[model samples]
Target chain A: MNSASPPDLLTRSGSGLLNWLHGWRAVFRFAGVAIVESLTPRTYNSATRSVVLKQIYFTAWQILPRFTLFAALLSYVLIQIVVDTARNFGLADYALEATIRLLVLEILPLMTALFVALRSGAATGTEVVLMNIHNEIQAIEAAGVDPNRFEFIPRVIGGAISVLALTAVTSSIALLIAYVVVYGPQYWNLPDFARVVAHIFDLPTLTILWAKVLAFGLAVTVIPITEALAAPKKLFFAPIAVLRGMVRLFFVLMLIEVLSLALKYI
Target chain B: MRLLEETPDAALISDSLPLRANLSVLENVAIVLQYRRNMNYDAAADRAWALLGRLGQTDSAFKRDPDLGSEQRFAAKLARALILPQPIILIERPGLLLPDTHYPAFLDAALTAVEDLFEQCWIVDYTWNEPLYAPR
Candidate 1:
């Protein structure tokens, strides 16, 4: 009942592949434009700055307290497990380094990316999809405002900065929690903790981490926007756009994490 | 609408050209000044306030699109369009945006209030609504 000619199936599959390639091409193209526009001095004006400030306030400053507490709790638990297990295995000397590497270099950054992606990235995608459906983007353009320069690029800038800020705050807190879990809440172990930190966070690792977090930040916002722009201008497409954006964001975040790990360790 | 689409200075106010839901009415109006003229936020807000004042809509400055009445929303849209430099105002089907009121009277009052700000004003509507714009 479902029989189809091989040539017809081949053509359909070929078109599907072309569509997939075109989708990715558009995403990268938009990302490049956003980056360029963000860097151009002419793009930063009163309106763009206002949008950037608002985006940072909503994305980073709003959820900061709750997110910090959650990160601290998770860090404490993970560091406790790592330290206790290492002590039980008669290798307590390496516990701090292991915990530092696992928590700071990997887990915390990835966690912050996921958190921002789920919260702000989804919201941005849905908003853009709705705006597209409403023809608001076209309207803005018709009013003599470049939507990319005034609206979208500013959000990308704010999102990247927010991810960096959140990652820095949470990672610093996690480091403090890691120290207390390892050395039992005293100043005597400060030198040892500093030594471990310095050892684990050499120049190359720091560079890789900073680059990775920035990449994650850009991906979270950029991917959603790109997908939402690609979506058909219809009300029912909003949810689908957000879903696709979130999935792509998650994949890209994981890829960045894996790549960073490979660069550092392998 | 199609005829004016290619005009470089035309500003179209229609159902399709809605206020950004995420922004306050003041922001929706001031953004044009901020982006096109590069005016700072305070100056843009002040100008937007002045424009809204002209329409007796200062009270609705901080409200969002969802909270706005039809007349207030139309005022905001009109103010936003007028903020453009020497704009050719194009109002497409005022009835759709102001369904519950006598849109002709509202449009007349609104345009008369800011007659000096725009270069010219145009209205596109269905033939059935011709009598609404006829001399009353």
Candidate 2:
């Protein structure tokens, strides 16, 4: 009974598209500001340092033990599967390379990013949304504090560092597990494993991996916070803000992963 | 209130300006000094502890916002505001922040406790609450 005319429907579609573009533009702008503020030497005072340390402790250190165990188990199982499949096809020589490419270069970083995004990203988003609703951001500003410098950028830095830390730990363990799985824990296969590692982890590959993981880390925290800041200052919008943040973050993470793969192989 | 807003050193204590829920009461109070004065964590914590001590809120130092009593939450907000250098304390609508308590008397006692820390103290409330501030 209330169907819109063609012109009205066109206008509504145009408006929705414009709003979508505006949201993306806001996210990029906020990310740029956070990056610039984080780089400024003056941002590393005692206050922000404390915030960053607490963030890292919560994001990486607190979950390190349990997450590492989980990742190790997963890596071993995956490596075994890859190795078995390769050996069945008389391609055992390519097993290590495939495992390294799959696990170390791609899977571990993505896993770590997802973990941080789910745990710390959601928490940061909810906290920020609540702060916005309660006018705490305004309060901090009124007290002569730059919430960007004092509150937000520190979290971005900490989250990025946490991602890198988790990725590094898990990736290293995965590599070790790959070796033990492929080479039976023998010291005699050390030189062969080193050769495969060096061949796989060339400068470009390493650089791309680092860039991708860093992008993942930044996206995890930055997307949530940007979305949270853009959310309406209403109690009901808190969950919506986090949901949008998480969805956007997942998209960005996948995009980065695809781009990295394209750069390395395509 | 407009005059207080015009000043750069004004520190507001209101229900709208809630303490950070993720942070403990001590962290909430100490963070002001840490951010503004660049005080180290230990020093800021010590100073915040002293401020909370002045309000007999040391027992609630490590508690977070949700865990705090109304009086303790108000004390944390007050301490956070008072930490500013030569702060002009702006206490807005005490009843909104401490609904169950006699806020006028509590504000009087709390302000009297930290009277020397602030340059001036202003209480902004609705006309309906005017008689509550009148001298008995």
DockQ, all models:
0.79, 0.64
Model 2, position B116: C-alpha lDDT score: 89
Model 2 docking tier (incorrect/acceptable/medium/high):
medium
Tens digits of per-residue lDDT, candidate 1, A1-266, equal 88779999999999999988987898889889988888899999899999999999999999999999999999999999999999999999999999989998899999999999999999999989998898888878877789988778998999999999999999999898888888888999899889889988899888999999989889989999999999999799899999999998898899899999888779
Which lDDT tens digits does candidate 1 get at residues B94-121?
9999989988888888888898888777
Q: What is the C-alpha RMSD of each candidate to the true structure, in Å?
A: 1.9, 2.2
Error of 1 at A144 (Å): 1.6
True contacts kept of 2: 0.70
Docking quality (DockQ) of candidate 2: 0.64
Cα displacement (angstroms), candidate 2, residue A170, comes to 1.2
Per-prediction fnat values?
0.85, 0.70
TM-scores of the models, in the order given: 0.95, 0.94
